[model samples]
Target: MDADAAPRRVRADAERSTARILEAAEAVLAEDPTAPLERIADAAGLARATVHRRFSSRAALLDALAAQLAQRYVQGLAEARVDTAPPVDAMLRMTETAFALKLAHRFAVQLTASMTPEVQGGLDRLFARLREAGAITAPDPTWGRRVYLALLHEVNDLPADSPMLDGDDLAARAGLLVGTVLRALGGVWPPAR
Candidate 1:
């Protein structure tokens, strides 16, 4: 260690710049996946060159973001404490968590349109658990994938200028979708009195 050398200032600015860029990109993509890179850069208060330096290109940035989101969603599921709740409620909470806390609502919704099957690798286990718990039905090996896409799009019809979705809306729609799919697939929910 060379104590005699002047202490180097921390590179806080570079870290902040990169974080800003990613945050802006995520926000824009949530609202409009096709938003331009230059628009994201402007939102981040950085030059397009700076954004490119960090993300390299649009596709690279989008892929990395999706991969990052998948990992985060899985981690949230693993750490979720849903012991003994109504099976339907537990499943609903998990879906809402993915949308609200993960800021992955757009990722969750648009995945079908993009048809990126790989994200299923991270999510499949959670879907399996939901099915085993009787929150959903295992109509086919890939039935959860179909239900997930369907449930998300059902809510996607919300007006473009609606307020940010919250836990309540997430859970309500999730319950309806999962419940319907379960019955449709020949599974059952606790009967109404």
Candidate 2:
């Protein structure tokens, strides 16, 4: 039992360190894509060697960031509290949640601009699974994912240096994007769902 307990504690510490490294690297990347690993390590309060051990290489970290960003967007859509509104309004609020998550993880947000098919697949799978599980309701599971994918990547691509990024403005734009997508999806959304 003691042997098993020691390993469990070790695993927990490793999980915590991995989270710290991700947070530090993401903050650095948000400001400069070429930020040095040593700076990330310093911010994470870990040795550079530790970061290397966890991530292996620069490409590995970037890959994780992109994948994480896409998945987080889908998850936010599933989890946000936007009930009691028209379906269209709820959809818009969920879009707001996704954008908020992206801006919060600005490093990953950049890669989401050119979201890879693998990331898109994750989004699709999550939407389908959630719909089947009744965690979310969708008239068509594919349609739900398509709408989210458009809002996240295809449509409403913000400029890298867009001045229209103040908190309130960004959110308003997100609502517009959500409204547009819902209308396009054959969502009636007259005054309600």
Candidate 3:
């Protein structure tokens, strides 16, 4: 075997283990935020020592999860085309993307962590554009954003097994979320697709 092969294999294994742990942590913690590391280890089908070796403490694990979530949120924003799309279209896209992310990372979202300033600023700009385009008539863009986020949170808080989260039902749930946000914020209905 090549001299470097063993080290490369070890690194790959470690990466897979870390990913598994994070995925399990998200699911386990979403159901019970106070679940112990042993519970997460069980969920991951990993030895407790392995989990401990990867994350020294629950806080460390949560910090890593938060960082991962932040990265995913940024990517979702980009995929939503928030800057370039028409205001109503952008809002709907963003809502759909956020609904999926929040549902997948319920524990992280429940942490009440704020996005990086740059990402938050981008979202603020999108809301401003929405107002400018008369898609939303909310006097305060901040209020509009809060209302939008709250709606997403409520929707994602539904039981994990809810039919709304299953397959084609996800799109329906997202549409309802967008429609409610639009109505609450005095935005154009049916979102001018």
Per-candidate total of colliding backbone pairs: 0, 0, 0
Give candidate 1 regions above 4 Å deviation.
1-13, 29-34, 81-89, 101-123, 130-141, 158-168, 190-193
Per-candidate TM equals 0.66, 0.66, 0.82
Give candidates' CA RMSD values in order: 5.3, 6.1, 3.5
lDDT winner among the candidates? 3
Worst 10 residues of 1 by lDDT: 107-116
Clashing pairs in 1: none
lDDT tens digits by residue: candidate 3, 99-145: 77877887887654536665676677778888888888887767777
lDDT of 3: 0.80
Give a tens-digit lDDT track for model 2, residues 7-92.
99989998898889889989988898899889899999999999999899998887877777767755654564333333444456
Deviation in angstroms for 133 in model 3? Answer: 1.7
lDDT of 2: 0.66
Candidate 3, which segments miss by more than 4 Å at Cα?
1-4, 157-168, 191-193
Cα lDDT tens digits for candidate 1, 1-193: 5764434323566668777877788888787878999999999989999988888888777766666566555555554533445445555666666556433445433442233444454345555655676555574536675776566566545543454333446555555555665676556654242
Arranged by lDDT, best first: 3, 2, 1
